[model samples]
Target: MKKMSKLEAVLWNIAFPGFSQLLMGHYIKGVLFVVLEFVMNVNSRFNQAIMYSFLGEIEKAEMVINYQWLMFYPCVYLFSMWDGYRSAMPADEKYSFLPFVFCAYFVTVGLMVSPKVTIFQVHPGPVFLPMLFLIPGLLIGFFIKFLLAAKLYTK
Candidate 1:
């Protein structure tokens, strides 16, 4: 199999969690990611929620979403992106996992609050709300990673 570029890996993983792994020839792990993602998608009623949300049926979308199953999504999804990106890199970069980890954490928090939280009186629903949280998560994670690296190097 041809090695995927880091961007290719991340984008593929974004499309589906394990595509990059499969492209990179980590068959077992790739299959596992796909399976896990499928299971979560099914149990969470994610697709149904997405459809309803897109149709402007916010209440129905909220009603259909299974928060328990949905909560696991951010962790699995972000982990796959991080793993794919990390695997594609020729050299290991320390603290790289922090951004993904924090993103997952913030996304999960966003999911928890999606039902009640709104910005400027507008509800972004389950999907968009969590996505909005991703920015702060990434920023905080990268900032922390940078500080950690600086501290380690300056010592």
Candidate 2:
């Protein structure tokens, strides 16, 4: 089987968790991710929250959201992307996992602060707020990875 590009794998995973794994022929892992995504989405009422959040019904979105289940989303989603990217790359060109690590951390922090944060006098709501925070997370991850790579190469 022909190998996929890292970007392609990441994009496929973004469309739906496990898709990249499926393309990579990791059937069991892919199925598990898909099933978990479905279960978590249903239990968390994520779609409803997204709808309410988009409609600017912050309170309604919060009310319908299941925080417990919702918390699992960032980790799973980011991990899938990381795993996909890692799988697609050549072994010797392996990248650090710092990006995924920081993304999960920052996303969780975003979730925690989402209720209290307001950007530009507007509440970002749950869905969008975490996404916004992801930018900073990615930046931090890249910086750390750079530092680590520099240190390693200097040795």
Candidate 3:
């Protein structure tokens, strides 16, 4: 099987979770991720929400989103990305999953509060709100990972 660079793997998964996995020949996991993504997307009306949000219709996006089903998105999406990234990483690489995990946590929190949270009187809605929160989560997670790797996080 051909190996892919970590960046490529991550980017592919970001485009659609499981693309990297499928390309990397991890058939079962790739198929599973694809199936789950499909199920969650359909149930949550996520695509519609995204379209509405992109069209500057935040209220319509919010109305179309099924929070109950959408709640599962972050974990699955981040995990899929992580799965691809980790697989592509060198054997000695450590703590590489921290950013993805933290991003998932923050994105989920963002998703939970997206409906009520407003920034400067603008509602970011389901898609953009969670996406915006991802930046801080990545920073924090990377910071923690660095600390852990440097032994600065002593018990």
Total clashing residue pairs per candidate?
0, 0, 0
> Per-residue alpha-carbon lDDT of model 1 for 74-105, expressed as tens digits?
99999999999999877857898899999999
lDDT of each: 0.94, 0.89, 0.95
Query: Cα deviation of 133 in candidate 2 (Å)?
Result: 1.1
lDDT for model 1, please: 0.94
lDDT of 3 by residue, 31-53 (tens): 99999999999999999999999
Pairs of residues at least 3 apart in sequence or in different chains that clash in candidate 2: none
lDDT of 2 by residue, 1-155 (tens): 44899999999999999999998898998998899899999999999999998898988998999988999999998898998889888876534689888988899889888989988898887888999989999999999999888887899
Q: Model 1: runs farther than 4 Å from truth?
A: none
* RMSD for each of the candidates: 1.1, 1.2, 1.7
Instruction: Rank by lDDT, highest first.
Output: 3, 1, 2
lDDT of 3 at 32: 98
* Model 3 TM: 0.96
